[model samples]
Target: MQGKAGFWNLSNKLTLFRIGVIPVVALLLLSPGRAPNLVAAALFLVAAITDTLDGYLARRRGTVTPLGKLLDPMADKLLLVTALIFLIPLGRVPTWAVAVIVARELAITTLRGIAASRGVIIAASWLGKVKNLLQLAAANLLILHHPYFSIDPHRLGTYVLYLALFFTVWSGLDYLWRYSRL
Candidate 1:
């Protein structure tokens, strides 16, 4: 049985699974037709669910490892960034909003790297987590990109993306401000 200190704990496996799903999700998103879009959205939703589950499992099971710490956020960025970029070509998401979100993600990731190098750990704040959740919601809805059950996924996704942008900027600025003070 894998112990809490083991590298291949269930949580880390889920994180790896999320990363592995990225390419397939990207392919589905790029494929033409509503069927492909729906599949991509479903896959993305699964990935998003794993995102939450991995963290919770890691914390609850005490199997949190350095690999999990590093890859969890990377998986999120890769999935979200890939989806948003593809959505741009599909005319589902605004290029500027994607740009802003991507910029913030890259900046914060860079900031975290710098902090790590200096023996500092910049943990994910609540605002940052909320930003990620909003981004995931937007990406899923935008990938679906169609009306269903009286809800316009595209329109709702746009609104959620806007909320995501606000949190992205806020959390990023918060990180920078804290880092600057250190």
Candidate 2:
């Protein structure tokens, strides 16, 4: 396990793989064809799955390096933000919602940086975890953009995005409040 403390861990490689997929997913998303969109959705799903997998591996292996801590969140931001940015021109998502989510992410990251510099650790709250799950669900639903029987996935995705936005703000505030106490 002590050997796992270095940067050359399996979990770190998975995190890097997630980052590498971001551009492929983005470029594939921009292809002017339905097949490419479907492919993009599939790639995005794989990348999203890696998020959970990497974290699980890191914790279970006790190989959570500082680099993993940085790269993990960076990979998450790049994947989701890239999807949202590319989807904007396609009119598949609300720009204001995207803006709110991005803003919250930036704010929270800045807060984390400040906390880390001050030797204060503020772990993620339950609300933040739920927000991430909802964001992934929303991104998948929007990417699929297919109607399932009586349900319009696009509409449901929009609602999910709104809920994610609410939690993003709520969790950001919670983090800020928690940091203030420390």
Candidate 3:
């Protein structure tokens, strides 16, 4: 049991490492005159994959820890926020979208912190998960420059970003309403 727990812990740490890589990857992709966008996109994709794998492994292996619970969401938010921030000034994404998403994240983080103080674990909701998936899809599309399988990258990216923005606002409000009733 001890050994198994240690392995899961290690996996959790790796997830955090992947999360930390997002900002660097974003900067690399955003740099002017650099065609390294594809490389950066690959890194982002790897990080996103690891995010899914780590959580699934933790649950299947029964290695979920309080630390993992805390760090996992933090990592997700960091990656999303960093990617959106980088994409905004490039005109690939709108400032309003980033602002709304970031605001929602901040509100949820604050609510979670307050709830945790009272020993309440505000579990991730289905809406929240959907919001996350949409956000991830948006980030990936934007980073990939929307050219996957002959898709018009720029237009597709804009559409996805807008969709993600809508979900972000919806989920944020959902959380607020849920919290009020609790």
Pick by TM-score: which candidate is best? 1
| lDDT for predicted candidate 2 compared with the true structure | 0.85
Top model number, lDDT: 1
lDDT of 2 by residue, 1-182 (tens): 43345897988998999999888988887787667777788888898989989988988889888888889999999899989988888888989888988998998898888888889776878999999999988887787676667888789989998898888889988888877754
Give the per-residue lDDT digits (tens) of candidate 1, residues 86-132. Answer: 88988888899989998888888888888888999998899998998
Q: Which TM-score value belongs to model 1?
A: 0.92
lDDT of 1 at 135: 91
Enumerate clash totals for all models, in the order shown: 0, 0, 1
If both were scored by TM-score, which would come out higher, candidate 2 or candidate 3? 2
Q: Rank candidates, lDDT, best first.
A: 1, 2, 3
Between candidates 1 and 2, name the one with more favorable TM-score.
1
Tell me how far the alpha carbon of residue 58 in candidate 3 is from the true structure, in angstroms, after superposition.
1.1
Give per-model TM-scores: 0.92, 0.91, 0.87
Off by over 4 Å in 3: 1-4, 7-10, 146-149
Query: Model 3, poorest ten-residue lDDT window?
Result: 1-10
- The sequence of per-residue lDDT tens digits that candidate 3 reaches over residues 111-167 is 888888888878888888888888888787787774657686668767887888788
